[model samples]
Target: MRSVEKVGKTVNDAVTEALIELGASTEEVDIEIITKGSKGLLGFGARDAKVRVTLKAPAEVEPQIEVISEVKEDVKVANANKETETVAPPKSSKVKNKEKKDSEDAVVVTRDELAHVQALAEEFLYKLLREMNIEATVKSEVVNNNRLSIGFEGKSMGVVIGKRGETLDAIQYIVNIVANKGRTEYVKIMLDTENYRARREETLKKLAYKLSKKAQQSKKPIILEPMNPYDRRIIHSALQDSKIVKTHSEGKEPFRRVVITPNYQNKSYR
Candidate 1:
């Protein structure tokens, strides 16, 4: 058996040398390209490129003892045969892992859709806020469940929020229809001023508890000030678990109010 010789050299100029020494064509040898090679740093550091080459006989000489030993060791732990069976070399001219419609797991929104939403919202918000004399700039924005959340950053966006964020809620409702005009699935628009909706939701929860206790104690149905439908819904939702009281909305649209009442069946309150 002819002893197979192994060669190693810096990757920068190793391919031709390896092929010549092994009496093999460039296509017969596997070339592995590695990134992040030794780079000189501050003109003081330099990296040495490296490559490994395995030489084979031109006439298919019998394997040497050392090569046989190494092959047996590789088979014992690496299952080299199994690894080769599992991984396949690329066959087509295209790159591997390219995006495929059905194979892709991520939700993809086209550039046209994103651009349409952004441009439409920007124009609408600019006009709406400018008309109200509230100078505000659109900040972060996102599309969720087909809805657009346009965050505004400006001096005292509290004006947009209005009393209990009624103005913001009304604006969002109207924008939702206009923004999603002629769409099969209407996108809900949310105009948030510095995350006002989240903060207001917390405040409403606290208010619900306070009103529930007050109504329970007074034994009278408290007709709170009229709020937007969303706000009324929030109040009702917040008191869903209260055993001492119940909440319901009264009136319509812009005049809707959340009324808290003591459990009517409680004879003491009645």
Candidate 2:
């Protein structure tokens, strides 16, 4: 594999410099952080971050060719044998038409159906808030004709948001269930307050980057705190393009956590 080392003010900068030198995308290389540079007090002991980027070996295409050759050889042998065998007859036109119709019958939400789901979600959310004695106005919007985004507004929204938006997530889950009951096409429901969901997503993305850097620097796996599937997805997506670290989740729901590990093979680095 071809490799190059570069230095910059930060890890991202160093990785970018190395990528430019190697003319490779993130998916085509494995990156190792040699040093996570620091900004010392008063710029007296400042240091630059250093990274080594190695281009990954090209994938072998010979195995696929071999498999195809084996299949062809089997076919040739079968033809040579010329043994009498029972063959199943082709399906009737009615059977084929029925199969096609079954496939085409897949449920799709129309504009009216989307509006119905939106109203149902909004109504359920409002009633739930009232029962909790949290005075908040529910606003709903349709997204992509199959998703509903519900927003809560009012001074008492902090209660609705709850700790880390757990309460909001639970409410959204229930609202989706209620809205999709007796419906063939499922509609997704998203609930948020004070832009909490968006803000939390941003925070998770930043944390993903920081932990990725730490994983590369320490050359070890970093297990993050437990997060819901939604938050876990945010972390995964944030580092999906990174060549230095890879992210995955483990454990069951409600306790599942994101794990960040350095993406490198068992090889010595210069």
Candidate 3:
């Protein structure tokens, strides 16, 4: 889906674009502002905001098929690029230079739109934390993967992260739900404190691989301690196709963890 958050006017340009493409009137589409913009510090911290919209129409009366076709074309292009990278070798200087140029060219951005998204995320994050009786300042920025990176600062950031960041993950999930409620476009939100989440994810991946090896050698199940949902998801995803071991998540939210078991039936834990 395409997104627009540019400045110069308080209007729904994206809705107009969607309506034009859908061959439908504005009334046929449903529009909602998922988040509000922010203005801070005497116009120095002023930026635009965003809204997510969804359009509905009768099955036979939908928009032109070209839109969907374009999305498919994009998917094909991405897959083709992936295959080329894996099969092609960087043997020639020309190839290497081209690859570097391509990488540099990939970062497409409209500065106004980016600033708007960051403002919206920061505003929503601050309000959410405040309602939870936690005093914190939420600041966000657009990062890779069309994701928003939110950072919490203040004396209570430690409280926000909680033990092993289980509470912090819950906070992030709530922020995502609240932020995306009644929205059409999907925006990924990542919350962290001092880069703790990234560091922890790397650590968990290492631990998952290490445990998989141990299970392979001992032919036994390795049950890990309870972890937050995100960490458990990481472990499960990391060992998805491990030939020597299988991974599964056990327990409920806030206490879930991944268990690695040998491929063959051996010692079991109940």
RMSD of each: 32.4, 17.2, 20.5
What residue pairs clash in candidate 3, if any at all?
none
lDDT: which is higher, 1 or 2? Answer: 2
Best first by TM-score, ranked: 2, 1, 3
lDDT for model 1, on a 0 to 1 scale? Answer: 0.56
Per-candidate Cα lDDT values, in order, are: 0.56, 0.68, 0.58
Tens digits of lDDT, candidate 3, 101-170: 6774565545564555566667777777778788876777777645577888777677787645757888
As for TM-score, the candidate ahead, 1 or 2, is 2
Candidate 2 residues lying further than 4 Å off, grouped into runs, are 1-107, 265-270
- TM-score between model 2 and native: 0.58
Per-candidate TM-scores read 0.49, 0.58, 0.47
How many Å off is the CA of 125 in candidate 2? Answer: 1.7
Pairs in steric clash, model 1: 10-49, 38-47
Model 1, poorest ten-residue lDDT window? 84-93
